[model samples]
Target: MLVLITYDVNTEDAAGRRRLRQIAKQCVNYGQRVQNSVFECLLDTAQCRSLQNKLCKLMDPERDSLRFYYLGKKYESKIEHFGCKQTYLPEDPMIL
Candidate 1:
């Protein structure tokens, strides 16, 4: 499945800034970043749940926000992009 994850972290303090970096780090391990705070990850059910749990624990519910959009296996037809940033296929091979 394709999971679109977005987050908003309050970066008004040092701790918030740290959280933002930590959150971004975690996201990068699982997927590609589409925007400053948005990521597109291709993962199975178990992987998705595990990632979600990790993110939920790192986030400050009172000050941060998180969202996940499950696009299932057929995500090609579901996503449309028209922007300056280059788009990528989640299923394609990634050269690290």
Candidate 2:
């Protein structure tokens, strides 16, 4: 299965970005840092869960925040429509 995970990290500190990078690397097959506080990633369900777990562990409860979107089949269609060669989509939700 293929998944597109887009995330927003709501913090401006260097530590916050570093922690997010660490967590992202753990689960993403590929990623692009959109800005200092946003990122887009491609992953599988297992990978997404692992990444989420890592993010939860790294974030400070009061100082850091994270939001994730699961793009699933729509992500694959977008990739193809944009000329990407990939042809699969995740079939499960990682948040469970």
Candidate topping TM-score: 1
TM-score of 2: 0.52
The alpha-carbon deviation from the true structure for residue 22 of candidate 1, after best TM-score superposition, in angstroms, is 0.6
For residues 35-77, write the lDDT of model 2, one tens digit per residue.
Answer: 4444556666777787777778876767766677666645645
Model 1: residues with Cα > 4 Å off, grouped in runs: none
| Candidate 1, pairs of clashing residues | none
Query: After superposing candidate 2, which stretches have Cα over 4 Å from the reference?
Result: 1-30, 76-96
- Please report, in order, the local distance difference test score of every candidate based on alpha carbons: 0.96, 0.58
How many times do residue backbones clash in model 2? 1
Give lDDT: candidate 2, residue 5: 45
Residue 10 shift from truth in candidate 2, angstroms: 7.5
